[model samples]
Target: MAHSPSRVFAAVSPSAGDVYRDENQSVFNRGRKQTHLSAQSNVRVIEVTGCAEVSSPPDRACVSISVKNSKENVNDVTNSVTRRLEYILQTARQHDVKEENITVTKHLQRDEDLFHMQAEVLVVFLDFEKMQQARTVLIEKLDKSVCVGDPYYSHSAESLSLLRRRVCLEAVDNARLKASEACCILGQALGRPLLVREEESREWSSSQQDTSGSPLTLHPRTDPTLISASSRMFVTFELRPKDNNRRKF
Candidate 1:
């Protein structure tokens, strides 16, 4: 992380500004139009693989709570779980959870003289703070018959799409930055990128955030509160001699 990219010509290069650029999708700084270059043997080129990763706290979560009870009569068991189910639904409403994001399931069974009934309610939340509050309220209100599962966190569909695209752009910019530094060392001027392609892409999620106050252990173990995306890009750029400044092809 300490290896800073040497800004040889970042001001004039594609890697100068924010990595998440959409105003103009073109990677290059648009001071001049890019011209096609021939693939002749004389044309010198450099190839590099650029990798980038991005992560953000989850924007969505789901909380599930289940209640069950046994009674001498079927109606009594049903009423027991239904009352708690209605309370759960009401709690979800009070917390501003949308109707479409709430789900409820019920089950009833009888054996011998004992009647058993169970009901589960699932609520989806867009705000983490609100989710925590809701979970707390449910635990405080419900009795031993109720079970509340841990909140499941993840990014929304639109958020994941945007994150993937942004990481790809960052990878391209990284490649350009690395190649530019290499050109400076070899005493050559960097030219337009000739080819760019994504070599690989991966995404994964973990269970929970780190509690030890230390960095993540290794690959596949990311922050529990976040979803992440990474991309590796292969790029080929043109190289030019310092003397031929005006000859652009």
Candidate 2:
């Protein structure tokens, strides 16, 4: 089957100096016929910057739980830590947390005759409410040796990728709108896009503020723990004088 030719776009920066001269001379001034065109005929190039942000509720949480035990014998301390960790895992499983989402690490230290063993559990929970319940139960039922840390919230990889793509497209649309508006004001007609460049992209929690100190609230009605994906684009488009009658390639 035959496929349509893919369009190629080139990004050009005004500050690129000699590179611009070389390309323009090579593409537009190869022969006398092309160079003989009216000096008044020119392609107006407009560059604009656009930005967009998208937000979605966090789909995952990282809950860290620490279990520590001290005993005169190494075997005793290890056994105590293992029991506490097993109980925590059982409680988490009962709350619908999958075994794959849980990670366990063991650390053993010897201070003279005393043996200290510690187990750290990092649980990735899909449901925030269930995670909260499990955390409460662990604290209430477990001994003082078990310590639970605050939850760190985030979006799943697939969800974050979707949001990033959406914001990037939106940013491009924003650039087009700005370019069209500028052309209208200058009494010129907008032409095909010469370049579309994504300058910066970032994903952060909506509960936190960005570097500008502004709240990243893309979805105000959703939970404050939502994740926000932001993108900035630099776009350049060709412009033609409104009265010009040259055909577009």
Candidate 3:
């Protein structure tokens, strides 16, 4: 009653062909993986800079002094600015502002024909109660002498300052947010991020700078209000972009 082996069943089975197909598929997958790895760049990576603008009371103030004398008397203007500078020095000393704190930035003529002179002084600490009082007194006294017979007190004073750290910190935070946003956009394009970089330090605006340090290269979108600690401030930072494997190659 048992059937012969040949008559029992005769069905075709894929053996070497199927094995070869599977092996080829595996080889293709391996090749793809290797290609992807080879295409990846090994460029050094750094994080996008983060900046926060914070608000804090300014620690100091700066002011500029201008004096002009006409009637072809350049000497008059020079003498006038000098006298006023000396007076400012005296008043600063009286207010406990160190003598070194008062500096005259320029003592030159504005034009060869017209008698004009410019002077500048930095009020180290306008927040100081004494310095504030001194400022008012010095202004009044200078108005009488430096501004005398100059027609409507031509001399003008302005308040300038460095941005408070709190505000700067806020700016840093804002900058970080911007950097993150940029990264998000870049991530969608370049795949993903692998690194970021940021800087930590006090930066000064052109107006706030003194006779020290390299000048800061300002960013256009810099929050002027935030940068202005007392009156004005400026800062700088750099951004870095990277790629991450987030998309199908």
Candidate 4:
């Protein structure tokens, strides 16, 4: 007779709970690794704001001239105003004022028993001395119908553009200097700039007067020709370890 074969049992299988626990631990470790890698890729940076201001003298002037006339005949009034305007234009051209700089804003003629005509002229002068001379000539040569107003001071467009550029450059330089100093104190080296932004920019005018009266009175008492510009910059710079051999955390 054949002996009965010994019964063999299968190895004990892992429980469902044990398998789930092992999978959860593996996922948790994977998440931790991803977080560590993300942290390492991000760089450390410092942010700073800098400001600068610059001032310059005025470079342009504006003068206003008004012409008015009234006569029983409309033609007479028109002719008189036209002559005065022609005289003014001729004088301006003689003084080297460009045609583009002259503007006639208003010209009106009302019809009535007594006709009336009125006109306003605006002339911009780049040369202050010529502007003064024009004013004097208009007063001396022109009749009472023509009136001359005070000069308005301002900076030319090109001058203002240059000033703005200079102020912005200064502000950026100031920000870089501050960043370098801060890095030195923290025992770190400054790396490439991460970001550069202009936060604020403005242009204004300021006036100063000389209270002390001196024998020489060539200059005006209140000088309104000073133009000022200011700018602010925000910069972010990367921070690196002073020792190049060591890696940053």
Candidate 5:
């Protein structure tokens, strides 16, 4: 074996021409290690807005009536107002108006030469037909001393509260529907809702406002004291690919 020492360091291994540099960025990613895609956009979202409006007619009316007269003596004036006061109450009860819904106030004073007696009746009516009937009875049976004022119409607290909540929910539903449609057009799937914001909310009567917050034009057949509520909402929704699986890039 010592006869050929030059062959000991011979060209048996690979030369520089035979060796090559690795083209991969990370050499550790080779061999048994598997490559993975990076997690991009953990949360992708789209924002949209929606609007809604609700309306209800006034459910109650307050009718006012006044009785006033002057006589030579305090007893005579008092008697006169008393007779009209009883008539007013009787008329309301005949029309099925509740006792608790009726109020009576009386006043008496001395003028220069006579006693002046005055009384007023306030009644709240839930049924418009009953209110009209009661009004007609008072106007027909009472003397000229009795004066009936116009009815005041309005909404109850409970009704207004329910209306506000309903309008807001409708607005939110509209927002979700709008977002879903947008995702569909964009070739994506709509995911869970991320957030909701009630941008604007307001309520007013037809006697006060319209769509632009101005005076509303009343229809002859519609209620003039109609109540209306409007709601505007903004919502954010997650957007995902129709196929919700990841792919190697």
Candidate 6:
């Protein structure tokens, strides 16, 4: 691929130092609280949805394992992952997992310091039916191998993305319920939303260190002992503004 100058130059600089302290202080204000009023109008402006959050354990896991070795010994790491990954694959098959459900997305190498090299193996799940059972089998295998370097585990991101959409819908409904109750407390009519916003997050693996040069492509072996499944989610919400102006009692 031809290198693009714009892409290579993409970076955020943090060199600013107190360029507008007085301006910022003048524009920002805090420490003010809304006071409850007793002679409020019969009409109530209630946010149709203030905020809501709910979480469910993830349904699958994304496990990526790597074996690292010295700069001149790339084959050593390759050989290690081969035996281990093969065992993991075999165990998945033994548990009745379909062959097509597992995929090796990437195998690559990046240069490290003077004497070290970094190798990566990317694995992903296409079927979740046998996830739990496969996880048990894989964890047992990993423990026995005592694979060097830390094991990086995560909730299946693709799976969590689907879950997030559903959870968002439920949260919106929950927020509406709260809005209705707020109106009742003020003894005023709830207003329609004038504006809305939403936000969400996930516990991402720390960003990988940058690397340069050609990548190695390794065929993943079927290994039961070096891989597993898991799940995760972050609470999030939608907020809407309301205008209380009319009520019928």
Clashes of each: 1, 0, 25, 0, 0, 18
Q: Which ten residues in a row have the lowest lDDT in candidate 3?
A: 3-12
Instruction: Judge candidate 5 at residue 146 and give its lDDT.
Output: 97
Residues 136-219 of candidate 4 have per-residue lDDT tens digits of 999999989999988877766798889889988888777777666656665676667767789888765556353232232224
lDDT of 6 by residue, 63-97 (tens): 45444344445566666656666676676577665
In model 5, the clashing pairs are: none
RMSD of each: 10.0, 11.1, 20.8, 21.8, 21.4, 17.9
Q: Show where candidate 3 strays beyond 4 Å.
A: 1-56, 110-113, 144-249
Better lDDT candidate (1, 6):
1
Model 6 scores a TM of: 0.35
Give a tens-digit lDDT track for model 2, residues 152-229. 776666987888888888888777776666566556666777668888887666354333334544432223376667
Please report the TM-score between candidate 3 and the true structure: 0.34
Query: In model 4, where do residues sit more than 4 Å from their true spots?
Result: 1-46, 56-59, 105-113, 154-164, 181-190, 200-205, 208-227, 239-249
Error (Å) of candidate 1 at residue 200 is 3.9
Which lDDT tens digits does candidate 3 get at residues 6-79?
A: 10000011111111011113211212221111224422221233344333323444444444344357777677
Candidate 2: list runs displaced more than 4 Å.
1-51, 171-227, 230-249
How accurate locally, in lDDT, is each candidate? Answer: 0.68, 0.68, 0.39, 0.66, 0.67, 0.38
- The reply for model 6, stretches above 4 Å from the true place, is 1-45, 56-58, 62-90, 101-152, 189-194, 199-249
Q: What lDDT is obtained when candidate 5 is compared to the true structure?
A: 0.67
Model 4 lDDT at residue 238: 61
